[model samples]
Target: MTTKRKPELVAYTVTGEGEKAYWTRIGSAWAHKDGEGFNLDLAALPVNGRIVLMQPKPEGDAA
Candidate 1:
């Protein structure tokens, strides 16, 4: 069966190899919304990455 792609909440970190120690959110994929949406903490990753929110599986059998 084919699988569908969904959003997910994730945390990313940049890897500048100790050269560039800084990271900023790229693009306008998401915006600040209090404490209800994705709170990306790129202090660790130090690189631009995505923090998605994966869709929940359909209720019923655990495929």
Candidate 2:
């Protein structure tokens, strides 16, 4: 017999300007994506995990 575990809740949002990504909660054990909607295996991430939108830094701010 197989048993399914309840998914833990985690909050995340989208990155780019494509879809309207509201602050939503998802299971910790579920594979989630960052703001770019990229595929990320966040099954081991904490509930407060934050995925930042990695865009090219500005020329002056490229430190």
**Top model by TM-score, which number?**
2
- Residues 12-58 of candidate 1 have per-residue lDDT tens digits of 33335466643333212232356466433232333345332333345
Clashes of 1: 11
Candidate 1, which segments miss by more than 4 Å at Cα? Answer: 1-36, 39-52
lDDT of 2: 0.36
In model 1, state the lDDT of residue 9. 32
Off by over 4 Å in 2: 1-3, 11-13, 16-19, 22-49, 52-63
Give model 2's TM-score versus the native structure: 0.21
CA displacement after TM-score superposition, residue 56 of candidate 1 (Å)? 0.2
lDDT of each: 0.35, 0.36
Clashing pairs in 2: 14-35, 15-35
- Superpose all Cα atoms of candidate 2 onto the true structure and report the RMSD in Å to 1 decimal: 13.5
Q: Residue 5, candidate 2: how far off, in angstroms?
A: 1.1
TM-score for predicted model 1 compared with the true structure: 0.18
